[model samples]
Target chain A: MKEVRVFAPATVANVAVGFDILGFAINRPGDEIVARLNPDITGLKIVAITGTGDKILPTEVLENTAGVAAYTLLKHLGKEDLGIELEVHKKMPFGSGLGSSAASAAGAVVAVNELLGAPLSRESLLYFSVLGEEVADGSFHADNVAPSLVGGITLIRSNESLDIHHLPVPQNLQVAVVHPDIEILTRDARAVLSDTISLKKAIRQTGSLASFITALYTNDLPLLGRSLEDHIVEPQRKQLIKGFDDVKKAALECGALGCSISGAGPSVFALCDSGYLAQAAGQGMQEAFALHGVNSQLYVSPINQDGVVIL
Target chain B: MKEVRVFAPATVANVAVGFDILGFAINRPGDEIVARLNPDITGLKIVAITGTGDKILPTEVLENTAGVAAYTLLKHLGKEDLGIELEVHKKMPFGSGLGSSAASAAGAVVAVNELLGAPLSRESLLYFSVLGEEVADGSFHADNVAPSLVGGITLIRSNESLDIHHLPVPQNLQVAVVHPDIEILTRDARAVLSDTISLKKAIRQTGSLASFITALYTNDLPLLGRSLEDHIVEPQRKQLIKGFDDVKKAALECGALGCSISGAGPSVFALCDSGYLAQAAGQGMQEAFALHGVNSQLYVSPINQDGVVIL
Candidate 1:
């Protein structure tokens, strides 16, 4: 195909139980990118930028996540001179802790790969996608990008070497994400975190993370619920997101198996055993946020089994 | 049966990647206890203690781990008045960081259950076993006892509620343990740890642990090898065990997948992918310890699939 359009799903990163190690993709409200290859043209070109959430993104190729991702892949494949034009459409809200930057980066690489005859495997594409995240966020973290590219639940074993694994996703697992209207910059959310944590708290968090992964394989919902705890990062980062406490409490009370801030927040996510619980969780979180004088939007979804897809 | 004898296997706690949350049982050198139910007599009794390693144990029922465990079970069963005589046999070395105490506690419960016509399931028996551990160690930690009781590798989800799960063991997985003739109390190993850890290190440790559990489920040996790292506890506690660095280096050089201190240490263990690697790892560790002027004993074993067995 000479050109292809791809959609990279939004992801819930950090996953509460695992600060920077775990994340999973969701189906709806993602970024869209169109990749076109022109043999006569040279290098990557930003053909256009258009979407509901485009106001917060940079139009410059070097500064944009999608452009940076395409450039990175082109450079890696020794095709930087090969003409490629990417039109990015940001469908998800920006800076809402829903992996907006990751979806763009993932979509760019996927669409470009399809446009270039799909030489790279999804895992191989993850490396370039993480590089795009580096350009957008000023750090190398694959927690969001890996899941967005590979789909389902992903564990970032070693982000430096790009060693990532896709873990088993439990059947009937549903995700409820409530994004508050207020924008919380990732930098500010990160800045509030303490440099060190108590060893006792660290042990608890690690145990929770390990148990959470085990529960996924065993399909133990109650055990999975108990494992979704984050004493290390959540306590410090939750303060950056307004009404987080109330939203989380409301989510749990309304039948969410567990609830916590998604990524750096302004977005909070809850894992539920069924669609019924997921809807209740979403409604509860929205009502709680409204009570705190905050407006919010909720997205209820099943675990996205497929990440980036061509359309 | 009026009398029954049981053998409880030794355990490796923490398992390098999970401090106080993960452990696995191993075959060979274990504790043996014989329980005799005497309807005519009242309360629990210590009949006799025998074995090459019995010198370290206390004869008093209240102070002895086996006796304490038996007594705890009888009290919980509301059969405190029923006469029970426990004869302890210490097969494993004491204070060797091989979960010697946990073996005695586990053996006592198993023998008593058999003597009483098996009134409880293994899972139900775990609570009384943990209570026995509390008496022996002055703390509530099931890392050793749970695995030694349930067999295979076990994750202690919540020690308080006794929520535990046994993970699958790979077919060719082997374990090599080298016990240096040195003792380091669990309390001393724990005291050296810093009150707090750097958030960076905590993240790495948690990622390692999560990856380790995932590797076990997927039977990914290379991934498991990479995950057997302990930046939080090993650095501080390794100093307490002599020749630990040399032993670990020797094991790795001998083709073991990974090596780390076994439990609180003085004993070091290596996980091997095959029997040949296990034998080589054992020899390498023993020789390394000898080079450090410490006498050592070696035990090569499969990942024990059975916890306590009646003979």
Candidate 2:
């Protein structure tokens, strides 16, 4: 194939109870990457960028997420000598905490792999994608990258070892996400957190996470809602996002099973049992954010089964 | 149903990553309780105590676990005026960290319910059992009581609300328990713990627990072994049990899937894929304890499905 284009879905990290450890993919508001053979150029290059509009994303091969991901994969395949050019199309808002950078990195690797006739397995490509995404936050966490690259609900048992596991998604599970017209840097979101937490809180978090996993396996929606509580991270980070409490309350009252900040937000997410309820929750969240004088974009989607896919 | 005898299986609480939140029942070395309707008495009474040599247990209705459980059930049923006598049989060692007190309470409640024509559902009985067991350690934790009452693996989401959930057990899963000839009180073990813990450790613990639950649902034995790690409670409590480190190492070396302190200390438990491996691990653990100049008792069995049963 001379050229390939892929869409990498955005992801919701933390998932209310699984801070830095769990995430799930959504179908829309992702990034698109186009990889083509450039016989004139010897290594990878970022030829064009679109859809980001004055955001001034990095374009250098070593600095750009898409560039780095494609470059890393090419290097691993001993194909660095191959001529290739990548065009990044950022469909999602930057710093919205919906895994915008992860979509870029994931899409790049997937497009490049398809252009090369798929030399590597999907699992093998995750390492390069995670490394590329790490440049955005300077952390090796894969809660966002894993789900954006592999889809469905993902669990990272050990970020150091990149031990990723895919959890079963209930058939009726849907998500409602509202990205406010504001940016909250991942570094700033992380800074609000404390180094130490009460042991009691830690146990409670573990119980919630454990129960959440069980709920997924058993298809117990009520249990999932009850378990989707964050005792450690969310409390500290929610203050950074405007109208978080009101938005969450609105979503829950609108029939969301659970609601919390998505990733390092300005973006808040709600999980619902049906598409209709997800849409209702999304509108509720948007209205709640607007009440705080914050404009927001809403997206309602079922759990994405495919992560990055060829267009 | 004038007189009823019931046996309550012993339980292993904590389960490595789920301190005060998760546990499972085992087949043998449980307390047996016999509840008889008495015409002469007008309230719950403890008439006989056996199987505990040189270890004096409380016989008073409020102080004794069995008596408390029976009295609580009777009171809840508006049958406080009914005549009843309970026989307390302690088959398991006290302060062994094997849910000895929980077994007594669970057996007492089950026997009393049976003698009263089983008016209360098993779910409703958990409250009385937990209250009865709470007197032993003065904490409202139900990790032990829930499993002993409901059987299989149980997760207590909230001790305050008495929220309990039963988890699925793999068919081939086996347990090996080694009680070193020593006793470590739960209160003392809890005393040595820090009220606060590092956030990094807490996240790691949640990841392990989530992975463990996934492993159970998927029937992934190797993943279960990898996730059966305790970061916060095990390290501090292991010091209270002599030869703990060596015993755990021995169990792992003997084909055990995972090994850790059973509940608090002194007694240790190992999980294995088959009965043979569990038996081997039990012997290895017993031998390791013996090398530390501590004689130990060993029990190996499959995951018990039936908790308290009629005798």
Q: Give the number of the best model, judged by DockQ.
A: 2
Task: Report the C-alpha lDDT of model 2 over B251-270, residue by residue, as the tens digit.
Answer: 99999999999888678999
Question: Top TM-score: which candidate number?
Answer: 2
| CA lDDT, every model vs. true structure | 0.88, 0.91
Q: Which number leads on lDDT?
A: 2
Candidate 2's C-alpha runs over 4 A off are none
Q: Write down the worst ten-residue block by lDDT for model 2 chain B.
A: B182-191
Give residue B185's error in model 1 in angstroms. Answer: 1.6
Tens digits of lDDT, candidate 1, B148-167? 88799998877777778888
lDDT of 1 by residue, A47-95 (tens): 7888754365677778888888889898888998888888988888888
Q: TM-score per candidate, in order?
A: 0.97, 0.98
lDDT of 2: 0.91
